[model samples]
Target: MSTPESCIVAGQLAELGHTSLYDLLEQACREYADKPAFSCGADSVSFTALRSHADCFARYLRHEAGLQPGDRLAIQLPNLLQYVVAIFGALKAGLVIVNTNPQYTAPETRHQFADSGARAVVVLDKLVPLVRSIQPQTQIERLIVTSLDDWRQPQEQGDAADETRFMAALAIGRTLPEIETGRGLDDLAVLQYTGGTTGVSKGAMLTHRNLLSNVLQAVSIIKPGEVEYGNEVRVSPLPLYHIFAFTANCLASVFTGFNSVLITNPRDLDGMIADMQRHSITLFTGINSLFVSLMAHPQFDSIDFSRLKWVNSGGAPLNLSVAQRWFERTGSVVREGFGMTETSPVVVASTGNTPYKEGFIGQAVIDTEMKIVDDQGQELPAGEPGELLIRGPQVMQGYWQRPEATAETFTEDGWLKTGDIGVIDEDGFLKLVDRKKDMILVSGFNVYPNDVEDAVMRHRGIRECVAVGVPDERKGEAIKLFVSLHDQNLTEADIIAHCREQLTGYKVPSYIEIRDDLPKSTVGKLLRRVLRDEARAQVQP
Candidate 1:
């Protein structure tokens, strides 16, 4: 009935030794002291370096600032070494980390600070002014800033008018005695916020046990034999703010003692490939659009792929063509996983070297239980689409400080309502249908936007696109597509015909509009809400 790894996680927590985030870090530091833990630009921190830096920052928080356990530490940086130092340091200091999106506006940043009640903020130096202007609105006390251009450069002193540099915090902390804090297993470790149905960011209170469960679940999914410990070279382009990359790439790689080369600007296709080639990357993780850009780059073909053992896709759905091209070009099959911020981000992933599945995300990850349920909350049969509910150790404790919201999200039986529509095959591969909120009702038929978008993307002329529901007099709701093209000559009729070959009549976009580009989130996920709003506006009187 259940997958093989499901039994492993459900009954094996005691077998895994770590008690908290600090425990995991200490174990890695002891085992791989001199091994490279993280790299940004040209600089790297060994496991011992990571431990020392984190300990130093923790010392400053405890000895210098007098902060106590359960204090929130807000981190607002992209994929940089400072992010690692601040996050690990915060965790080691027994502080709950609030992973703020670096692309957030001043208002958004201020909201998170106020909501999380963060005492200290570790941010990119460039964004300090933005935070400074809004500092009076929150409870911020300490401001640790660092330049992405040079995180490793030592500075004994920082800007007197503002606050200390990220490196200066480490220097000051090192001079103090060891930080005397180690939060236990049930203590909160992270506050990864996600926009729920209310359209407001609600923090997910992920505990130390939740993160440890996910780290081990993900590591089990990725066999040790497939990736060499302390020797694997991984090119991680995803931002650490997102739970998917935070747990899978940053946390997992560090726990395994693998060297991760963090890319600040994954949009630079040439540079991402350059980093990959330089590291002779054994593992690469990215979204569908990022992989597409890399494949389209002129220099992508020149990169060596002899050592590439894995290519992972998450954060969004993996397009079939992108997966096929990656495998054909690099001889490394893409493993697509699925999860959300509340689930510690990785609950399912395709096993090693598995060939591409058209719409399948993967089978259930270790200790994770997923099933489909209809409107009445009754469980659905395998292969029947319905809202997916999940239960596992990796699932979050609850939404931070929102008891009512958290209660509504979980079933009385304890399953987390995923708010996503999907189908699980008899063999356990989970195939995504679409977000429940984004489903279009054409007459009596249910049309999933992802289905239409996936079919259209296979046309070769379509470079990127999003599908949304529009009002229709007869059908109640009709499909409208916004797409950007790879070929200037491609026409609406060409797209319509391509859809006819792969989808049913109601599933095809009734209106196919081409554009220079579609609006997307900072993580490159197509903003379906944007397109949906635009579609509704066109129908307004």
Candidate 2:
């Protein structure tokens, strides 16, 4: 058995020069003034113009909206140019950004706004009614709404007492004097909320140091792979609200100067493909399910993938079958990485030069330290899977306004309890097992869902699959697998027979169900919790 010191691993450290996100943005604007920074559909904005617009919005927030420094501002919208403007503007005004998912329900939206104590909200016009229904219940005093095409034309203020169009705010802001925001690295930058798969979503209090360090760490790892500064075009299909995209795509762009093509509706395969053809993208960021869906598109093969340098897979586990299919089609190996909303999101990643490995998730990223520990909080040796603990500059300060929850999430020595089960090899490569909470016990034997799901997905007929444990009288818990198949002729018996080849007796699924499509999040991560609840309900009655 190895000691704790032998088990701990650290990545090469990277230095962060910028004090805050504002400082980084200003530097990018100065260096890449005329370069295109972002594009949505047919519209594009240069770095200089982006800075001008952000300044205008920041002035309006300070002067007209009466939002003071350190105020909480909830930004609820999809992937749009307006999102970039709003986020940068909020940072410049010294406001803490509360990124809200456009796909969230009214209740979910209200909880975030109310919990964060947000005083103002910038929401999509289409979802205005949902916000209005719950606005009175929240602390939101100022309302800023935007439409899909609002950036193209002037917009009028709404009839509501405090409702102002997003365009109108920028317009009003341009007339005000430049306001100085006295913010630093220690100040809170964003209130990034968790997925709430376990319970109520808690906002992870991310500081400027936390986020900026991550961007630098990512740049240090990626630049050595020959990714040019200020030259590459990154196709960003993931939502910016998710931390995976927030830091990796948006914040990282300020430093790398990559022109990001925002795909508002990734579900629109035709539109996404058209944009791919138009941008000649060099970098791509997406999840496993999306890779499968994109390859399934008939026109997918038509796009030229020669310029594609990197295809990053995060937000979900990377399936070996899907990764191979992507590599075969695009001639680019999928660089798998792991992160969460808490760590400013980039703890470990496979660099551009790293060779493709089936189940390996690379190593701890720059300045990050990682170790595996047992339930007793004692460190585990190499090859032994346990809860992964992380300590890094990118780790969040704490959960917002929840001391008890925050204390429970961290150890006394300050390592963030990642709640993920992973194994670290002697070479420091990590293979994620599954979420600690999702582990199943079958007659005193531990069975990981990822082991079963990965085995099930290898079958040629299976399209997508999720494994969850359900209650059983005989075994205490039984494995239940849900799958969507490419071939309708394949039977549950076939899947069972296939699993029997790779998985142990207790690990093999006891129940199998065929479905047309499984529940998935907006980012295309399989909603195992949702399916688990449904499966458990069915078994109960």
Candidate 3:
């Protein structure tokens, strides 16, 4: 039993006994005050500037918004300088953060707000309409609307009726007393939501210790490859709302004094390359789809990859072809990791300059223990595929407000039951086998078939729909939809357009097939497995 003190005394690692994330951020603000903390387009926020701005925002949250400690603040915005500010500010104000995807539809936003019982929301101006339409259905009261122009200093503010200005909050925060965040390590810091097998999003209650430990664990494993005294410049194209990016790129970068570049849309390979070349980024965090997109780009080889020290991929399985091409194009290996929201999103990761291997997701990270278990809760032998169970300081407290689901998600001794089936090799490497749930993966984003089906079925013309992932050369898996329509006149394009409005782009089905009827069980329940097998059969040679 290594005490937190002993761990710190044993070696040089970031101390994990802080009261909260704000405690760590306050320290970083003092140590790397002048360094670039986060950047988006032409706007860059220095560590010192970030602290001051967050202070102002926190004061406004506590005083103006009337939000008290432990109150949940939902942040719905893309990767921008404002996203970083609001995250730190919410922590400084002793509020729990519920990261909402900016691309979420109105119904999704409503569900998250209603489930989390969020009182305040900071949203993008373009997304305000969605929030506005759903506010009546949720507890959301305080509305803070910002724009892309708000990344820096906006010359003219947009017309937002009954909504507070983001810059205005910062200005008011400057005058109010500094927020005294009285949070303990055991206090809830974030409510990271992930869709269950049922397609209903459930929030994972993550305490400060959970996240702080994960950050320290990550920092220790990656320390060997990091530049001396935090000279690491990281390029982050993934959404910060995702737990993987939140920990790896945002929190880790701030703690270690890395210059973090925020890429809003990586689909634009030209823009992404331009930013990468501009920063001479040393560390890259992306998914298989992103890596493949960059490698296939015309200007990808033209960019300098000599400074690229490491490339970390997660969210989806890394294909050998993409990894090989990435290493050949850039002089860096693609190290893959595996995790879930309940584990603070990191369970296994390749560390240091270790030779990257296909199929394997590296050894368990620092202070993290994992095992393979059979259905009877018995441990499996090495090289045997079973449900992967994880126990670590980084594991979440459990699903928020869902005791039964939480109980079912963990073993009697408290190991988190990662729904992923995996086998651990004799050398302690973990290789995934399959997903126990019928969840679909599209471009590294989890797309629950039920969620997509539910959205499509909302259309009056659609009687029944089935969503499944099919093999994609660019994305590891792309969604294909099978539909039985009440109105035969409805075209695939019509249903797709309807779905585009209801779901995010990634979750939208790329291929649609008209079906007379969908396979169903004797009890009249939709047999998703039957459809999945049929789809796989179609793709087979």
Candidate 4:
């Protein structure tokens, strides 16, 4: 058992070998083979069963599907047992896994599939139509679809029937071409897509080493003496496609041999509470909104919180009022963290038992260097707000197919410019003041103003448009649009209706303002700060 300070100074936090994740699972299976590894409702997968299933699927992908090393396989399934099995199987077969959100539309899915040059896709049956519509436009040559009931028994069967449709798909793939095995520690494992501040989505190439490094760094932060390995229970409700959950919840749990209770629909708070009670969950990882919702739920008071040991929050800033109320009720502190899609998504986190500062995002992780720089890229002294830059083993290799964009993201000295405005205090804790770019964070999802403006400008009646974020009580911040209409007769409803068709639900503007002209800079660039100030003035009275 080692202290957090000792672990940080020891510099033992680095990338694990490619085989380390699997080897840890083997050890867990050997020790606790009959113990549950994952559970959902009445369905459960034991450590032994999960490892055996992963091995079977890995062999199937290598021998039957003809998938070779470096081949890309896009996964568009929700949180389920198959999601873990597919990801581990693909990695074991030496294939790069590209994660796609199940909520993506046909165009969005096509763009990622085509860009990654993926040869095959594994998706849910409900989303098969979205994939089928995009298949003609993508390079995907094979499609494997699984139903929601593939692993669950039918109502008439009374939960006793074994649904083997999922297993059958793996068997079919195994009976089909033999592919070469190319497993290596330094091989590429994941291509995580991120929407840059410029509103362009690029794939950040993450190798096995990059992911392994993040997992080791996260493990080091948790005081080993405070928590026991193999006996700890974790709840993972965040979407697995996002890198934040992929590393902290999924990979970290696997590395420590903990039982992870997966929640497919986290919005079902009542069901989540039931699962928490059943498992006596010790560690819970989620975003700010999730914690807020859980605390506000009427049934929240019924759940016993004494068994909980750790609570981790990320993706967005935590609300101070919510944190205080949560601690009052649960007797546990919410450990806030910060990171992005480029750094394997875990750069810093607060200690589990420490008293939390309202706005600080904690100190840098082990084996990582962080500095704040001005617009000219010169490092700034402490207590000054500047762009945060980071360099570490967990940093991504580069963006896929966009060498120019990749080069611009990193500095000449190889540090990754995070585009976040923050200041470091004397204690090394960083406080985020604002974002360098005009990216709006609604709840926890990143919403680019340019993406909304682009969609709004497509309307025939709209002449000019700009989007900004305004403070909101529930969502942290809500999207607000300022527009000049080409046709004076057009109303705000008309503009919102047009945007709804082109943008996602979260990206649509919640408030609309009509203006004859917008403020601009000497270079004719839109001054979003002026618009934000105008919005603030209207609410001050």
Over 4 Å off, model 2: 1-17, 195-198, 223-225, 439-541
CA lDDT of 431 in candidate 4? 87
Q: List the residue pairs that clash in candidate 4.
A: none
All models: lDDT?
Answer: 0.80, 0.83, 0.84, 0.77
Per-residue lDDT for 275 in model 1? 81
> Compared with the true structure, what per-residue lDDT tens digits does model 2 show for residues 1-541?
0112211121221233465688777888878888999999999998889999999999999899999889999999999999999999999999999998776666668889999999999999989888888988899998898999987875876758899999988888988999987688778999998743344568999988788878877776674757888999999998898898999889998778999999999879899999999988899998765787899999999999999998888876666777788999989988888887888898888976555455789988767889999999999999999999998888888889988888888898888987889999988889887666676655434466776787788799999999998866435568899999999999999999998775556678999999999999999999999999899899941
Error of 4 at 524 (Å): 4.2
Q: Which residue segments of model 3 deviate by more than 4 Å? A: 1-17, 155-162, 223-226, 353-355
Clashing pairs in model 2, backbone N/Cα/C closer than 3 A: none
**Candidate RMSDs in order:** 10.5, 10.8, 2.6, 4.8
The Cα error of candidate 2 at residue 318, in Å, is 0.7
Model 1 C-alpha lDDT per residue in residues 188-278, reported as the tens digit of each score: 9999987654335689999887888788888887664787778888889988888988998888888888899999987677777778777
Which pairs, if any, clash in model 1?
none
State how far residue 351 of model 1 sits from its true place (Å): 1.8
Candidate with the greatest TM-score versus the true structure: 3
Candidate 3 residue pairs that clash: none
Quality of model 1 by C-alpha lDDT? 0.80
